[model samples]
Target: MVLPLSKDVSGKGVNVDQGSLNIKEVIDLLNGDAWVRLVASGAEGTWSLRHLHAVIGSQPPAWPDHDWIYGDIALLRAKLSIDRLKDALVAEDCRRFSVGSIEVEVPEVGPQVGWRRRPSFEQHDRERLQKPTWDLRVSAAQTSQHQLNRSGYLVGRSCPSFPDLQYAFRAFFEGDFSLNGGMSLPSELMVIRVINDEGWIGPIHVTPTHIDVQVDGRDLLGASLELYSTDQRTTTDLNSPNTVTFELPGGLPDTNVWLWLKKDGRWLDYRALYRPWATPDQLEAAGVKIDLPVDPLSTIEALVSGGEGPQVEFKRSLPETKSKDRNPYKTIAAFATMEGGWIVFGVDRDELTVVGLEVDDINGERDRLANLIRARVNPTPPFEATPYVIDGKQIMVLRVDSGVSPPYGIAVDPDAKDRPEYFVRRGASTYPAWPADLREAVMSRQPPAGFPNGMGGLGGAFPG
Candidate 1:
């Protein structure tokens, strides 16, 4: 006879009550399929299960199955399922395994079984049928799988592919099969060796259309490499050095040629390019030398003596103003009002050409002009007059100093009442002074006397 099924002490038919299960037994059960189901239910309640084997075992129940019960099974299952859902919904949240991209989660089972037991069933079993789906298509597209093999992407590995395509193409053209370092087409065709300040000369032989000359490993483009030939001028384009050719005209004689490279609109010498050749003395003996002069004044004197000065001539007629006589007073006043300058007599002011002076005695004429300026001009200007010889002709030069106090007034056409005008020099050209400029000039001319050291003297202590 089948004895009445044994009942637990709680009077439940061995289907133990939730509270009678020990913490260890409950955790064990939760680690199984039951945990996944509870996580899916999203319930606020708690449950328990009894482990008869552990309770009946000896050794004071040291929490048997410690290896399998190390973590919070129920919480782990819930978090795993939630992450799975997020991976399915979010484009970037999918897992990237060695095989491929896919979504993964804890398997679900009936309420009685635990998630740990789900993997035990065969592939055909309904519970074991749980498999990762390719819902990670978007993530697979977003993942940089190919980039993973690049340098620095992973620790202790080298990139199998080059990062820059231009470098690869250049390497191929240059007959370099290994695309490691950056490469490019040669831009410079000819190279010359020079010495000191004398000159430059050499024969540059290149196989390809162009042979690059790298300075510190950098390619110079659009630069000009200048070479001076005994009979002709030679220049090569930095970008297209192959097409541009520089020949010495009559087969490079024993004489040297001056060569230099220009890049970024700046000239670079042989020393800068680190090319070796002859010394300046050797080059000079070879009839090659730098074109620049050591002394600029000497050059200027040579040019002037060579009849290069402007061909200037003076007009016989004088300037016709409303005034009857020469306004010597106004002329002196205007000169004194600006920086001291020369006012050459017998010279046309507009044409700036000198006319021969018509006078009896050159020295006496200059003295007479100086006396006229001093007597007629108001507020006598500090000045001097002398006769200067230009092209074998005597001309009076009146050198007037700037006024000690400016706004040096001049009665323009002194005879006219309202025609009084004022003039000042801005730069090389003269301009009619505005009222403000006149006032500023007048103030600037005066010494800083009787003025207060600070604002406390007159105007209130500076405006805030």
Candidate 2:
């Protein structure tokens, strides 16, 4: 039977820790039944324990002896000890009964006979019972043993923390066993607020890496804000922040990502989850978005101007044609050399304009370009190639997200024999990798998990 525990029974509410006479009265009510069920505040929320003893410390018998006896003798003896201590003082009761990896107490005992074990509480059984007490044998057939076993484990695990054990017990009960495997990372959700001259606003950032942001209440639409990333080049446009959602190519890594809010050109970085690291005004200012156009030229200007965004560098287009090289593989190599960046075809760096390239077919050209990048570049860069129409002219935008490794090596020509030359990104340009810096970059390229399985590329972590 599901016994209702105290729910605001007094003006001050029932204190589980405070020894009260009402708690003694509730125990006395259980004394008249066979296998009485009592719902009491346990270390981990409410717990239901069955009383199976026939008598309580020689108290006057309230029920007949036929009410008990169905299971093991050890289980029966355990209940008898509980029955003897019902009227005992709270301190004495806790000392004698609460021990080991579980917290249990005998507040009072009824005149009912003790059984081996009582069936667990259930919804159907809850309806049939008139009061809190019920016969255990009648309900035994309906109880699920699996759930009981899990409950037993919870009881054992939460014994130490007492009342504060609710969080841990609830986590297990709700099937949040991801931590059981020992590899899953613990995470929490949080809100950021940002405040600025425009007003206050807030935005939610999920598991950000490096950014400071907060919510701003004054700006309900989330317009006034400040956002910044530790990685200087990695900034967000208050007007046009890309809502990016992509897998890490595997499972999540152990590292943390931070996201920040930017408003009116000011930045405030905030940790998105767990506890709020910024003020309410800061969070309000951070969540707001300022609408603006996003174009390749604008993107380049932002990167070159040392504004917030990914670190980027532009290069002068090579004079050679795709047919002349069988594959403009050298051009691909050039980009890979410097931590990977976009190679905008038909745009000259020395003179920015659409100096087009001859293509036999767009599809075939795209395929060949993709293949060259995949095959020619050493430690192949992770990238995507897509054709975008600008000014009624087609431009291939190669988006590359390079590894932290530096001195991306390039083979001058496909047939080059010696070690390929290495390059690195320096400001808005690419330069040959310095010997010391190249070594450091190469060493840092190795992922925490280990080196790549093949091609010396790093492998991402995966869920076990």
Worst 10 residues of 1 by lDDT: 49-58
Over 345-406, each residue of candidate 1 has an lDDT whose tens digit, in order, gives 56555544555576668887766666655545556677766665555555664556666766
Which candidate comes out best when scored by lDDT? 2
Q: What is candidate 2's lDDT per residue for 146-207, written digit by digit as tens?
A: 01221211223212221222333323222222334321111111000001122222344333
Residue 184 alpha-carbon offset, candidate 1, angstroms: 45
Could you give me the TM-score of model 2 versus the true structure?
A: 0.34
- Least well predicted 10-residue stretch by lDDT in candidate 2: 186-195
Q: Can you tell me which runs of candidate 1 are displaced by over 4 Å?
A: 1-331, 348-353, 412-421, 426-431, 443-464
lDDT of each: 0.34, 0.35
lDDT of 2 at 21: 29
Residue 363 of model 2, lDDT score: 61
For model 2, the stretches where C-alpha displacement exceeds 4 angstroms are 1-311, 315-340, 344-362, 374-376, 379-381, 389-393, 401-408, 417-419, 446-464
